[model samples]
Target: MQHFSLHTHTIGFDGQNTVEEMVKQAKKLRWSRIGIANHFIVHPDIKKATFYAYACKGNYQNIYSENFEEALFKFFPLFQEIKRIEQITQFPIYKGMEVDFFDTTQWKGDFYRIINLLKPDYLIGSVHFVDYKGHLLNTHDMKKASFMEQKEILKIYWKNVRSAIKFKAFDFMAHLDLPAKVGLGYGKEWEKEEEETIALLAACGGKAEVNTSALRQKDEAYPSNRILKLLAKYEIPVVLSDDAHSVSQMGQYFEKGTELMKNAGIKRSIYPIMIADHIRQRIYMDWHFMRVR
Candidate 1:
């Protein structure tokens, strides 16, 4: 029985429900607390991204930003409303962001600074976009890209996931095997990379999640059974998340998630205490004097 969820989105980003509506649903489930992790998609090249130009309907103008300071300012209203709701309902609501992990020194520097100032309760590291041949591609839009482009992007996508973990900018990883959604996750070419990622998480004392949303969208959960089994072998800390995008999605189908975890040999789940402390104590970035904590 999972008591909480930290992976959720609301109207401000790409979700259907309001914060108040989500909280109302949470009350019905009688959760201890929940985190509202809206998409924090501030990419320098997002304005130039060409994916889903015709395949998808989202304009994505308000959703992406190149300016970190402005983005932080824009998030203020959402956080304020969360605070108000917490006080009124006496329910614990943690401020969080489902960040799109970018593997650049500038991006990291800006991210670290903004997070320090925002002081969000938690952050989820995710790679929903991959830079492919000068154009940024959304992972979910994989079906729209050319076969050759998809092949190369899949390669880059896994590397980006690795970089995000090595960067240590967020609390835990999200949708570890997300590409499987588009029929590319369990490929022979990337199996070695998947093994390395699992080993990397264990070596770092890092945490991960069994995202229940995958079950809703597909036949299985994110971070699939094989990954979960390896996580158990490594004794890595795990959390179960609905990854809810609406009121109906909150704390739903956890029983199925638990069953998957059980089958995967994950005996227990953890409440992680550390954030951004990498696979190897600290990231060895380019700057010689810049010690990132």
Candidate 2:
């Protein structure tokens, strides 16, 4: 099985490992490439960071101001360090961010500004929260919610996901069926909407990710077999990710992910480095200029 992983996290955000440690683990695992994707600016409407903090029993409200610049500045160095590490190791290390795309209407302006500035090697758009009448219902916090509430959350979550793709801020949609992974909802009743969502994602340049993290939860990998088949049928590209939070999880379960893809009859999958091809082009342009000089 091919070995690589793009959806990983480190200490710059909530991840358990540091960049150096994660890289070391990747090398130990004999991975050809590993992309470090840290959490970027969360949407104000979703308030993900704050919610996560509260859920974890920590104080996150004061970590930054209303503007979010302070939190961003704090995290910027991690990206710089990732670039430096790539230079030294000569191994493929991509700079990426996992942005919460909960409500495009509310966060489109912030999302565009941050994405333009970062110019990340890639972006993983994920919907972590759903808006219900102005209140945000976090998927991770569903243990406290009612069954009806969870169903409504999934409905709005998919709607926001569609909006996120339309915004075109990410290279791939992270965990397309994330709501279903938690067993919050999504069955036959949602099949039509799922088809529509996949169609919309394909219409845009965005693709879906086959996230393996769901397996740890005893759930089928994100974008289950049925969804993967739909994506393949529509000719939508799919990327595989471990969504690893620690070094040990780097490239975790990729063999299974690839097997799932094969069973879906998907002959090809996108490697994360494909997103950095543009940078390679620019480097070539610079070299040509030097030769002319």
Candidate 3:
């Protein structure tokens, strides 16, 4: 079967592989398309001096101090190279960012500006942090919060997702159940919130991704089988994303994810790309496009 993976990161972020090495691996896997959706730089306060010092501390430290513009400049050449390879190899490569979305009420401006400037072919919206008294509470920290507080944090995250969809800032919602993956320990309560969130996504004309990263964590894909069924009930399209941080992980666990989706009765999904504005308009209006298929 033909395969495509849209959520991958290379050395541009915390990923372990280079873009070329990733391409080679994807080719080995016979993937028809692979998108390099690295984490875009979000903070610019750290220069090379501070960045190296921060990296010395550990991966987690560097995660929060990413220099967005510097990362973009570093990755642009690799992106161009990937485009060149596509010309010869005909293996599709898409450019996009896995943007870290904090609460929209607080951090929306920066994300909005970056999206407008990049105009990426695809974008994945993810909530990696929650706000707490001017401090950034990551998912790791969020797990320690009280049950009520955890619910509030998830509610804010879902709210931010809704805003992202309303703004049309992303093509897919990445790792829809990221909070769950962190072992928030909310148990069944999260399901109710998920139901509401899935309904909201459907209303906003947005799609949710079934990220295979969770498979590596020894869990089923995010938005578990139950949530996937709820999404199907709401008619919210489901896309399978690997969230691959290495080339070998491209299209990884896709078979299992597709099987889960099939079991849930989800039959169709959408993949985003850069097309002419006229064509985009027609597609937006539900016009048939033989080429898109």
Candidate models: Cα lDDT each:
0.78, 0.71, 0.68
Per-residue accuracy of model 1 over 1-293 as CA lDDT, tens digit each:
76778899888677888899888888889887788998888887776676535323664355577779768976788899999999999987888888998887888889889987787877889988887776777766675777787777888888888888887666778989888877776766777888898888877656788899888776678988878888778877777889887889898778898888888888777553323447756322110111111
Candidate number of the best lDDT: 1
Candidate 3's TM-score:
0.80
lDDT (10s digit) by residue, model 3, range 80-134: 8767877867776777678775544434676665556555667778766555545
* Cand. 2 TM to true fold: 0.85
How do the candidates rank by TM-score, highest first?
Answer: 1, 2, 3
Could you tell me which 10 consecutive residues in candidate 1 have the lowest summed lDDT? 284-293
Which 10 successive residues of model 3 have the least lDDT summed?
A: 284-293
| Model 2 lDDT per residue over 1-293, tens place | 55777788887466777888888888888888777877654545434443655745653343222344654675578778988888888777777777776454545666567656666676778876676776666667653667787667777878988988898867788988877656755568888878899999888966778898887876478987888888878878777889998877777777788788778877667654342246555311000001100
Candidate 2 residues lying further than 4 Å off, grouped into runs, are 45-66, 104-106, 274-293
Backbone atom clashes (below 3 Å) for every candidate = 0, 0, 1
RMSD of each: 7.2, 6.2, 4.6
For model 1 the local lDDT of residue 113 reads 91
